[model samples]
Each structure stands twice: as structure tokens, then as C-alpha cells.
Target chain A: MPGMDMMDMSLMQACMDACAACEQACTVCSTQMMDCGPACMNCADMCNTMMRSMMRMQGMTPATMMAMLDATVAMCQYAMDKCMEHADHSEICRMCAQACKDCMDACAAMRESMMKMAS
Target chain B: MPGMDMMDMSLMQACMDACAACEQACTVCSTQMMDCGPACMNCADMCNTMMRSMMRMQGMTPATMMAMLDATVAMCQYAMDKCMEHADHSEICRMCAQACKDCMDACAAMRESMMKMAS
Candidate 1:
């Protein structure tokens, strides 16, 4: 609260929505097969976590924030790779990959805004 | 995959472990009351996400990673505050606050490590 003067409710809301949607998409995607299931499950949980975290921004410092973003981006990347392995054969994988990408983008945007504000 | 050889599995594992422990603590904490319930729910979800994301490190940029960390730290702060409000009277809240503090510290360490590696 002390260092967060730039908390944009609208942007944060949209990002959270995207994260929730991505989590759902990835959850459905991961249940498709064992190959991608582990990563998808991980990503789905992470995205959901990320969304809920954003919804409650009353306490945070830049260090903790960046770490979480780093983890999220890593997860999305892993999920994307796994989903692509099945994208050519599965509509669900394709959609899941897209969702991962979207979540990554949204998280990045949110991070950037926070960084600028904090700085 | 291209952007993630800096991942130290041991450190990541430790951080994830801490996250899991914090998640479980917060989940248990949240069931204690209506006062801290909402924030506890949010924190528990965020910690789980943060932990899972760390486990999957194939896709991440420093930027995305930072955003997530920021979100997580913020979440922990909120959770701690909520827990503290009940800490005087509730043992669970006191324990939950400790978990949040530990998570915040672990995530910070991990973030710093990643930042140094990325740089």
C-alpha cells in the first residue's frame, strides 16, 4: 500500500479475468493427456494464483512481485511448449497454448505497469 | 526453454517447498474465521500459484517474472495484515502470519537469485 500509487483497478481487473480464463483453458487442455498434464496442471494453478493475488494488492513490495512474475512467465513457457507438442492434433492444446500466451502477455503488461509506478 | 538455464533446481525446489508450506498454513488459517477469510483465501491461492510457476521454468522473461513476484508479495502483505488482526486472539492467525512472512522472504531470495542470473 505504501509503494503502490499506480494501482489501476480496470487494468488489474482485465488482467485477472484473462488469468482466470487462461487457467480454465489450461486445466481443460491438461486433462487431455499425460504428456502435458503435469505442466498444464501447474500452469492452471499458477494462473489462478496470479489472478487472485492481483485481486488483493493491499500489501506488496517490488522484490516479491517480480519473483512471482518470473515464476508465472516460466510456467507459461513450459505449458506453451507442452501444448504445442499436441497443438497439431488437438484443438484443446491449441487453445491452451493460446491461453498461456495471453496470460503471459497480460502478466507482463501488469508487471511493467507496476514497475514503472514503483520506480 | 531458451530463456531459462539460470534455474537452480535446488533453490527453486526450496522456494517451492516454502510456498507449499505457506499455502497449507494459509488454507488452514482461513478456515478459522470470517474476518481474515477473504484475504486468506486469496493468499493461499497466490502462494500455490507462485510455487507451481517456479516448478515450471521453461517460459519466462525477467519482466513477466517480476510482475508475478510483485503480485505475490502484495498478496502476502495483505494476508499478513489480515492474519495479524486476528493474531492476538487466534493461534491459527499467528501461525498464518508467520507463513506469509516466510513466503515473502523465500520469494524475495528466489527473485534476487533470478535477477542476478538474468542480468
Candidate 2:
């Protein structure tokens, strides 16, 4: 429930950047109409939501932040798993998988930092 | 990969409509700086993605559709949970919660219809 005053801006910014990249990658991958398309679309939406939540910390509590992070991680993982299936044949899927991995890691780091700050 | 030829257009259209309504309501509620803001924002993104995916069913498989529906349902449930906490004091939250509920129901129905058709 703390304001931005208690949060690390750099970490938040990095997470947002990662989310944006992942969203873009997923969006492009979705257009390929592969079996991963729906997962890609889901990941894109989740990443965008995660990015915007960080931007609007005034509207979030630690609880909501944790929930969003968990959901983002889940969606990213699902997307990445699907993309990895065709990664060898599809350049876009490979890129999307990497982006999802990066975004998941960034979100996890953000969550850890928030926990440490709260404690 | 059965084309939209086999889909119930009316059900898909209704689901898309619900998703759009939910997205708009959540977007509006998220700007209110309420504790539900993060969840509302997340719901908005998910709803938009769901609507768009329906519009572009060419890119989706039944498996992906089921996964997306699950994700959308989870998000809508979370958002509705958060909004209910402040519904008595916030009209926007109340409306957003209703929209989320409607979208969730619509998505569930669509999923059920898809299952029946597949069978």
C-alpha cells in the first residue's frame, strides 16, 4: 500500500521495459497464426497490464501487485512454453519466447524487491 | 482449426460484445485511483485481447481458445473481487464489477459451446 516513495524506480522501470518488449513480441507472434497465437495474445495482454500497473502504482496495493505479478508470470510461462514448441522453425516464436522469459524474470525481481522493501 | 464456418457466430459476437463492455468499464474504473485499479487495468487488457482473438479466430485453435478463456476468467474474477470491496462507494467500480461478471459468464458459455461443437 506504500506509494512510489518506498519503491525502487529503476527496478520498476526495467520491469516495465521488459513488459513492453514482451508485449510487442507476443503481438507480432500472434499474427503468425501458429498454434501459439492464442498464448501469444494472452501474454501480450498480460504484459501490457503488468506494465501499466507499474506506471499507476497509486492505484495498487501490495496484494494487488503480487496477484498481477503471479498472473503475468503464469501467462508468460504458458506463452513461452507454447512458443518453444515451434522455436526451431519460427524466428518470431523464438523471439517471443525469449521476451516472455525476460519479462517473467523482471516481474519476479520486482516482486522480490517489493517484498524486501516491505519487510 | 475448423474455420469460423463451424462456430456459432451469435455466441462469438455476444462474447466479444461482453468483452468490449468489460474492457471499457474496467478502463474507466482503473483511473479512479482505487485499490482495485491494478486488477481493473489487468481485466481491461485481458478483455480486449479476448475480443480481438475472437475477431481473428483464424489464428486460434480450440486448445488456445480454452487457455485464453481460462486466463480471462481468472482475470475477471480477480478484478471483480477487488471491485466488490469498494462497490458501495464507487459507481464505476460497481459497473466494472458487473461487466467483469458478464464477460466471465459469456466466455464460459462460449467455451461450453465450443466443446459441444467439437464433440
Candidate 3:
């Protein structure tokens, strides 16, 4: 609220929605116990954290938020890559990969907006 | 694995277990949709993230790990405080609060160990 005045609320909301969707997809995907299970689990957790941190913006600084965003993006990318390996055969994996990619893009857009606001 | 050679495995495992427990408790508490629902939700996400980050330690540096631990501890503390406000009346709140306390302590122990290793 104090330092977050410059942030675009709509962008943050979109990112949070994407994170929630990714978390759900990853949670379902991890239960399949595929090679991507661990990665999907990690991605689910990171997406949840990223979404919650945005909601609790009072507890965050730009630097910390950027660090979390970067971590979330990396986890999403890793999970997406793992899911893609089985996409040809596993419908669930293919859908999970799509969710991860959407989440990654949403986070990237949020990061770019934050950078723009800071500059 | 590379930079985490000096870390104590048992302590990390304990912390991760505690995080998982807290995440479950908070998830159940949030479903109650009481005054602590939002805080419980935030804490659940943070605990899940903390546990997953430990599982994926190769992605972590000391700095990022410390930052995450601090954030998680703060979130747990906040959730615990909120749950405590209803602890006298709600059995679920009492259990949720206890789980949050356990997670906070476990995370503190992990942080202390990491600090000692760094020093």
C-alpha cells in the first residue's frame, strides 16, 4: 500500500490468477508420479508463494519481490520443460506445461511492468 | 549440492517436514473462511514454498535461502497470531496455531544452522 502505489493492480491480479491456475495444474500433474513430479511439485509451491507474496505486498519490497519473481519464473520454466518431455503422450503433462508457460509469461509481464515503473 | 556441502541434512529435513505439516494445517484452517482465512492461506503458501525450496536446494544460495526463510518465518508468525485470536473457542484454530509455531521454530533452527555454517 505504501510503496506499492506505482504497481498496476490489474497486472498483479492477472499474474496472481495465472499463478493460482499453474499451482492447481502442477498439483494435479505431480500426483501422476512421472519424471516431472518433483519439478511440478516445486513449481506448484513457487507459484503459490509468488501469488501470496503479491497479495501481501505490505510485507514486500521491490528487491524482494524481484527475487521471488525470478525464482518463480525459473521454477516454472524447469517444470514446463520437464512436462514438455512427455507432452506427446501425456495429455495431463501437455496441459500442465501450458499452465506453466502461461504462468511464466504472466510473471514476466509483471516483472517488466515493475521495472518500467521503477525506471 | 555444490555449495550446500556444509549444511546439516537432518536439520533441513526436519524443517521441511515441519513446513509440510504447517502447510496442511493452514490449508485446512483457510477452508473455514474465518477471520484468519486470508492469513492462513498466505502462511500455507509460504510453508509450501519453504519446503519445496529446501527440496530443490541446488537452486538456492545462502542469501536467497535466508531471505526466503525470513519471509516464511514472518508469514508463519502472522498466521499464528491470527489463529491465536480464536484459539480459545476454535479447536481448529488451536491446532493451526500450534502447527505455525512448530514451523516457525523449525525455520528458526534451520536459519541458525545456516548462519553458523556460513560463519
- Top TM-score model: 1
Error of 1 at B50 (Å): 5.5
Predicted complex 3: CAPRI docking category: incorrect
Q: Write the per-residue lDDT of candidate 3 for residues A1-119, one digit (tens) a residue.
A: 34658899899999999999999999999999898887788778788888877876653456557656776777788788889999999999999999999999998999999899888
lDDT of 3 by residue, B1-119 (tens): 34668898999999999999999999999899898887788778778888877987754456557756776777788788889999999999999999999999998999999899888
Model 2 agreement with the true structure over B1-119: per-residue lDDT tens digits = 45436888898899999999999999999899878887788778778877877876644556667666776777788789889999899988899999999998998899898888878
Model 1 lDDT per residue over A8-111, tens place: 76777877887898889988986776577777887788777667657667334455555566667677877887789888989999999999888888778777
TM-score of chain A of each: 0.90, 0.94, 0.96
Which candidate would rank higher by TM-score, 1 or 3? 1
Model 1: per-residue Cα lDDT over B3-101, one tens digit each: 667666777787788789888988898787657776777778887776766666633445555556666667778788878988888988899899888
Clashing pairs in 2: none
**Local lDDT at B51 for model 1:** 71
Please give the TM-score that candidate 3 achieves against the real structure: 0.63
Enumerate the candidates' DockQ scores in order: 0.31, 0.21, 0.16
- Name the lDDT value of residue B67 in candidate 3: 59
Determine which window of 10 residues in candidate 1 chain B has minimal summed lDDT. Answer: B58-67
Q: Give the better candidate number (1 or 3) by DockQ.
A: 1
